[model samples]
Target: MNKDEQLKAAINQKLIETGERERLKELLRAKLIECGWKDQLKAHCKEDFKHKNTLYMDKIMWTIMQFK
Candidate 1:
């Protein structure tokens, strides 16, 4: 993995290890928005950066991993 992938992986691992579903959800939302998931997010929800969940995160992260 490259730096970005590594970083995302680290974050994902940490989030998984936290053992708190709400905390994980909140952080996943914030991180996804922060990391440019907005456009796709808008398409997914008909709004921009409104909310996020682990449901879409792996897909987004996979897309991210495909770049560069």
Candidate 2:
């Protein structure tokens, strides 16, 4: 299998063994959102070397992640 499929299979196997598939899925979704937000922020900040804006974006992203 490909790397993505292999990772999915491994995750599924672990969930089956632990019986926490639903909870794990939720956590994964939140993590994905956080990662996406981080990527977007980095892309935006690349053109503007503004540390304050980057810090603000990080804080906002973290707050949203917490609520998720």
Candidate 3:
């Protein structure tokens, strides 16, 4: 309607988006921990003599073997 009303609406929309982003960050952190992401990263790390198994990597081991 008015310039001031439009500005308020825009500010409110931005605040809602920011809140959603923060909630998403927290949810993603929880999912990463639940899925063993930290452990999976360590397992696939480029270190020697660390042949740890991971869910996705196990499926692609044939291709990985070509690199070794």
Best by TM-score: 3
Rank order (by TM-score, best first): 3, 1, 2
| Stretches of candidate 1 exceeding 4 Å from the true structure | 1-19, 43-68
Q: What is the C-alpha RMSD of each candidate to the true structure, in Å?
A: 10.8, 10.9, 11.9
lDDT of each: 0.66, 0.70, 0.66
In candidate 2, what residue range of length 10 has the lowest lDDT sum?
46-55
Error of 1 at 51 (Å): 25
Question: After best superposition, candidate 1 residue 2: deviation in angstroms?
Answer: 38
Against the true structure, candidate 1 reaches a TM-score of 0.32
What TM-score, computed on C-alpha atoms, does each candidate reach? 0.32, 0.32, 0.39
lDDT per residue (tens digit) for residues 13-51 in model 3: 886877975787789989988989756655555442346
lDDT of 2 at 67: 47
**Leading candidate by lDDT:** 2
Candidate 1 lDDT for residue 62: 63
* Model 3: CA > 4 A from native: 1-18, 46-68
